[model samples]
Target: MHDPSLIKVGSCYYGFSTGFEGGPGNGSITIRKTCDTTITTGWTYVGTIWNSVPAWITTRLGSTPPNIWAPDINYFNGQYYLYYGASIWGTNTATMGLATATNIEGPWTDQGEVTNVNYPIDPNVVWGPNNIPYITWGSWTGNGINMHVLDAATGKLSTTDNNLWHIGNGLENSTITSNNGYYYLLGSRGNCCSGVNSTYYTVVGRSTSITGPYLDENGVDLNSGGGTTILTGAGPEVAGGGADIFDDGSVKRLAYHYYDANNAGSETLNVRTLFFGNSARTGAADWINVSAPIYTPITGGTVTVSSSIENFGWLKSTVNDGQESSVSGAMGWSSSNSLTTNHTEWVQLDMGTNKSFSQVKLFPRTDGANKGYGFPIDFTIQLSTDGTNWTTVTTKTATPLPSGAQVYNFSATTARYVKINGTNLRTNPNDQNAYRMQFAEIETSGMNSGNLAVLKPVTASSSYEGSDWFTHRVNDGQKNAVYGSKGWSSNSSLTTNHTESIAIDTGAVQSISKVDLYPRNDSATQLGYGFPIDFTIKVSSDNVNWTTVVTRSAYALPGNSVQSFSFTSQSARYVKITGTNLRSNPNDNNAYRMQLAEIEIY
Candidate 1:
């Protein structure tokens, strides 16, 4: 089997493959279905789409036997078009044909040949930015990969052919996808079908326009023999090729086949996460292959830490800005800053609101040739919601340290402010007896104090109260019960197995500093009532791509006070609070419910 084309219709995913009848060697097109949206499990064979080659294909092949090589499936205007290749092994007489079906499980209507060119093995149709349908196909022996506009209503080429791209090494099985603002061309390189000896791998090139001049990350033009490698055989997987990409709601996923060495180099379907990020070297957006399937939702664009350091107030001892030995850089308290001092000094980052965190990282000064200069020899990390009372997070005593950043990880804790107290100083290596304490940067990771949900529009998976206890009540800014009730409550009474959620949309993407949740405190009996025992705070920019900012299991809320959670800043337009295991309200003995008085977002 080779060249699997995947498409999603309704609630199920369908895959079409080129294969033979007996033990997968017949020249027929087979289809399979899976209810799993990710297509990772529970695949059910849906039988063959075509077993015998059509008379037109047989006439075109002439002396060669009728056999399908590559089959690609795409959906357009409520019709599924299965484009397939008809040719013999290692021949240039290949022709592409189309078959249409209204439903995935189909009685396909043969649409005959669509392309007039020879060796049009891999036929993939993609909708361009202008919503125009374009089909691309070619083989190594042909004129590289060729593209032409398609009339989707008639299932035929509507424009003159254009040479889209090519690589010096023989490559074929082309598939194109438009993402962000660029069109990506994925193709197979090297030889295939040799089992463990197969050198087949995947390479990609991109262009702003779908017609011509595709380039790789290094600015090497695909038309001039340039491509960036994406996937290759490794370890048990002998060869990876025949790649295709599709949007799986949140992120793009690549579906291909790999020869498994351990399984006698049998070709098996493989799917993995595909990430697109800016290439630091090329300054262009490039595709990334993550080895495993990622369940996390990705916001459409890059999210860096907000540059507004002043938003989170700062405090420090010996705050001098002019001298290079000032605490200004250290007190700036951003990931990028270098602070130096010849005396013991302390710096604190005030988050402005209560938040939770679990880790702190300290970077020693390394701005110039001086590495590890003025590094702290001993220090104490403390957390506090109120400045007066502090809880010692960790203490270091005469610890030998290395240059660069060092991270201290601990159990999740809550704080409104974090302080790094320099109890002892290390002598500057270049200048002995010159006691100093300096750091390049300091960062706190995990949840911290800030309400990121304040004033945002609220939504829920299911609402218990249509009017009074609606989802919007959580963000209504009323902490105390105004008229006997304080917030939103779920309708699932005593239903401990149900999962409920409330979400907020901040309109545009904003840097999320922290989230604060206030439990229902209106009535004396409702104190500490209906708080989620297991909960997750998720953030998303497009509502569909959600990333879990924090997940707490078997958590208990004390009283009706506000609970703060902090995370390394994430940019999100939507924030959701999901609860699975809810606490039983004392007033309602039969039902486990979720209730929140207020939610704040910062």
Candidate 2:
């Protein structure tokens, strides 16, 4: 939720998009200043750069099971260019293709192929220190990744084809990043898209020089088995796989995909935040997911807010300044070299001095040009302490045109810095709510009364695997798994018939709440059971003898479904599920994957 008075910023919104079905991999395009942490504004979706069948990407490649994989973006020759792959499903034949637009949202022109590697998958382009163009990409057909120099302007492969390194028998989805004199190459191994049965995870390797040998933590050759695993799957429904390496100025984060037992990679997106340690290269870093990104409101000082816009792929969308109709002239927004005609541009206010102001206002020079869409403006606002660190306050919206100055307020209590972001412009004539640009003056003042709080879990527990697996069910979806996906299928539970129960480490306890129970469900055609299955739910403060929370007998469970039940308990540390009986479905390995989603202790 965005506070109208405050500008909300941060790439966390990518999670919202990630969770969306058919969401692309470029994640979020950001025009961030170095120090902005709460990341209040200035980000947008350029286009679905990675997904092969992204609705809009249909012009070149026809929609089929396996088409486009991942897309990598970089700016060159005064234009924003997108390089993507067109690989044949379950086969190599991967070709790197190019598209360029004067703006992020584009009327992109397919520039042709960049690589002809047998399995030329996962293509990444970089401009070296001397301004020479270089390309790096990996293959799924073999253990090696190949690198070569390219025409700085044309992207044609140079004469040299140096084997950067090789790792594992086959590596999928490889990423390359450069920082502080070191080049980092990251990749994920094992099967991806297995739904609940996926064995996907991530690993990383780095090199000091742009060329040659990259090594993992123990100094193993990534060309062979040299990279170290940075992340592994945990809890129920194996997680991990498909990792992208990105830096938001302040920290480097590995944004990847995972299937929570509840949605199984259906509705929500999950990411692992990686922090760079003293070593500086990209390897040897601890990663974890703590809910989502954090935002701290600005308080007592006035500071200028500015940004460097990079089209995060989703371009050629609707972007309007303020004009009521498409006939009305609206100024096109652009990066120093944006490709789309009505491309989205980033704007910032030089607050002059560092003073905390509650509200900031932008006066439009005209009713301006409005995209045909009803409410044309879709942008975010952010605040910064020093011109560097910024935090997003909230997202703001506006009609085609406002009389004088349009006021988009935010509730964020940020101090001493302010910046507004303009993004998500719809360019194609058929698109809607496109954004344009116009500016007058910005006003700032006072703070609001709310202090920030943490998002606490409403339910809690841990599961352990044991002989003769157990199945526990949580049926009441309301109080047990608060603020979750719709339909009963959104609940998380753990069902195992183990003599030993799973142990959940509470770290620390807050207050109290209820527990829910439900039978686990899987989509494998191999398992057959109807609606309603019998199961028992148990709770334990310590992983010892447990007390039954709830139980049912000979109940039929909905096919591939989730249900919940609730109970009162103190700040307990562990929870268990034991399978007393099985429905008509045959007992198969992992017939019951744990459904535990969240634990709440108030």
Candidate 3:
């Protein structure tokens, strides 16, 4: 069995799986139904939806008993649509067909081939924000991961040509879901069907629009080969793929199959909680896997370095002295001062005060085209408070670095000065003759400090017309001063005086230090429209017990800018911002509302 797709209707859940048996009805799509909402047990085989390969499919693909694979079932407009792929394995001559049923256990009607683009497989459908139904399907040889708007009634392509969205080299099984104004594309990469040797894992990318140039957290476009790994087989699980995401009211869960390492790598159903967190580099949210119900923020605050306390400021073997300024890329570090050498080198940073740190991040030189060129192949980290006495913390050997920052987590240790010594420095991976020891930045994370509210579920008292403007937008990581399309706005034309508030649930209690609010500035005529005049920020552990962190009454906010309010760190799981007195739009007398581009909590 392969490529299982899941759907829930009423009290029962239905799953469609891929199979190929060699007869008239043998290769048809298989189905299983269960009443267990938890989806851990009680699955009853209900048999295949199609009795045999449809005549139309066989004629189009020039094959009989076409191997039907990767079936997806979705209910829309009071009808169940089953989309399946019909093709020969490892070939580009394939077609995706649709079947409709009035019930889950159906006497179905075949809708014939939707498209015959490059061995189209893995048919998945999702409704966009505009309520238009879009279908995504493709395989390795064809236009990888093609998408097209569908004629809702006919389940056929709305356009003449299939639109190629992402080129997943040998990767397929594409699925999509939307949350917090972003559409995430999840796909399986690597060999699948090889049992214990299967290299299949799940990769994900996201875009603000349904049809998009989806990008990973590193800002690499999916079309240009970029996706963040979300789940891979580990320990007892050898491989994981064929993923499907479902929102079960309270929280979202990912349902997929993993090859069990202990059980001869048999594919078995596994489920896990999924989350999205803020990405500082892209100013957008990215998916994260969580073990517990509570989420851990991926990005966090780093320890402040007061100054460098190095034994040798420059590389002794180099002709020009390598400056200590290269050790820190904080404001004034010049590119010319980047420490460079081919021999052993060491740099230490004084953090000004003794602090407990759990993680250290090293950023290699990314200037010009020398990305990940001078990173160390062997390195060790040490900690010292008095600068004279040092304790070796961790050592890494012969690790080839990628073109991005690498992070290492360690047992919590206290130190005012941190030192890193490098030997066996890497020459350029592309150019073996080029050899130098250089780095852009070294950062450390202090204990109990990070963005607390990233990707948490948010709710608001009200929305302006309840259209695109929503409360969740405030925390969606889109902070554009001129593009009002991505922020939250309170109701328009408010005749009665009332307060509007938006609240976020952090999933677990966390210490928060500050909140930054960006007021709306999307319109030229209404540059400061909907800026809150008087507001109060509050935190709460239990929703019933609230503690006011900051309160401003009759205060005017600056337009097109971020206003930050800080207070002593407080612990809470929920944070709320309430506008008691909203500023009236200068252009509209009746419109007294509050709009915010983003809300950052740390």
Candidate 4:
């Protein structure tokens, strides 16, 4: 949305922005709501305020423009008034329109034109000194900024003492807020709508009188094209403008849209705390700082260790449960390698679905008894979409001191699985110097899309048909479970390889991008023992005429992990995994069968 406006109602916040090409306001005003208590993320679109372009606007312009201009919303005199424009870009022949409703969620009725004089465009309402509310608007096209007394009763221009008074200039959008004893005029200067090449930035000027001359920090009049630069951004986010302030009964929040070069120059909404401490709050200082963005805590997922010493409170889940410090007792993941013989160990985190991440951190056991006793002697950090095809992100040839957390940073990538493979283990001095792999916590993060198939309809050619290894377990989003909830397994009767197949229906035809298969993780000795050795992945629109997208032979075991298979996009309603050569579990007395703990479809 261009020139977005923000407002808070109770615990809720709403954003109204200009429509896109095929959206409601090239047809009407688009509305969206906040996701959580947090300012923004996964915003819920609340439909357009109106269906078609207002008849008065189309009649004034003679034809509908491909898109609409900036808009503002306010609550005044026990009603909500929405101000919009009937104008095209780079033209002086424009008018600002008004719509008012009893409530925010409204059947807003158009109250005709608010200003058709002197190239009026971006319109906003700012209440000033006495009990008067003033409407302000301006663009670089004509006089910078203009304010007129707004009659709260009719939500229009006042009949007495109202004039098109000039204030500040530069570009569209005049967001005025009265702080202490001064009125501040905020505007965006320079060209916009050019994406990365756009040079637009925000500027500010202040004035003691509500309608008189506004001056920048350098004492230059805004009417003379002078304003102090406040927010000059850089790429990834190149241009920032169309700013508004929202007070939530506490601090004031500044909201705007910045063009992101990394995402094909798409404009994205941004909000930050406008910190004006005591001095800045009193106008003694002119500069204000916008706090850095805050990130949400980890969207945790089920964790699986190749072989953990769960007998001692060293469950795999402890590794990511925020208990790395000395506050807790002996906790975190520790391998079951009690013998002196060295063996490679691994731990993996299944984020439930595909995610985009960059950094992975591992915290060593902080207990005084074993500060860094089992820190990996040599290790590699690997990532995968499906647990099968692994890409080594970084390698530690030599072990580092177990003084604190080990940090690994790399270029951002999207995946579903993260694995820390300890190739060589450090010897525990307290346990007869036995080689081991230990860590208090491991944190790897990123955002998520989600799985399309979790508990969807599934069928299998042969299932264990027991309470434990039922066929539905493959799509239950579980990686760690006891034998009772352990995953799908072929029946004893069909013990031969290539005798097992499972199919999932996604409820509707979707563009299939990837599929993941997870190995059973409950049994330490049987982990990764029954994974399918050879398999074929097939997609079908009708579940009859199937197309094979991938075929694998000599696929390595997951070591009790997931294997992700990403291929060319395929339109399908059903996905099938057919095992050609099943794994024989030596731990299960050479049981020839197929088994998988979970499946993820993306």
C-alpha lDDT of all candidate models, in order: 0.67, 0.45, 0.69, 0.76
The digit string of per-residue lDDT tens for model 4 on 341-371 reads 8889999988866665666888888777778
Q: Which 10 consecutive residues of model 2 have the lowest summed lDDT?
A: 1-10
Tens digits of per-residue lDDT, candidate 1, 1-602, equal 36778777667777887766253324568888876433644467887776566778878888535347678887777888888877777666878899998878788888899875847888878887668888888878777787778886787888454433333235688878765678788888788878889988777788878875778777787767788877766646667878777656554667887787866888777776554443323323344333343211111111122122332222222122212222333442222122343344566667665555666777665545556655567888888877779988889887685655777755556666777776676765565446655555565665322343444456777777753575656765577645633678877765556788888876556568678888877668778777899999999989998899899998976575789887877878888899988787657775777778888876
Q: Where is model 4 more than 4 Å wrong at Cα? A: 277-289, 293-602
Once fitted onto the true fold, the runs of candidate 3 whose alpha carbons sit more than 4 angstroms away are 20-25, 159-170, 279-602
Could you tell me the lDDT of residue 67 within candidate 4?
Answer: 62
- Listed in order, each prediction's TM-score against the native is 0.50, 0.41, 0.50, 0.51
| Model 3 lDDT tens row, 1-602 | 36778777776678887865673356888888866433534467887887887888778867764458888888887899998888776656888889899988888888888877767788889898668889888765665787788877777788654565553444588888877778888888777777888888778877888888777777787777788877765546667888777655545667777677765777776655566655423435445543321211123223222122222322222211222123322211111122344566566666664555556667666654556766778988888877889988779997886677787666555566777777676766555445555555566654533445555677788886354566656776677643434578877655766689988887666567578887776666766667777889999988779999999987775767788897766778788999998887757776788878778886
| Superposed model 1: Cα runs more than 4 Å off | 21-26, 64-66, 159-169, 280-291, 294-602
Error of 1 at 503 (Å): 17
lDDT of 2 by residue, 278-339 (tens): 22222133212222322212222222222222243211121222221222233222233333
- Displacement of residue 602 (Cα, Å) in model 4 is 38
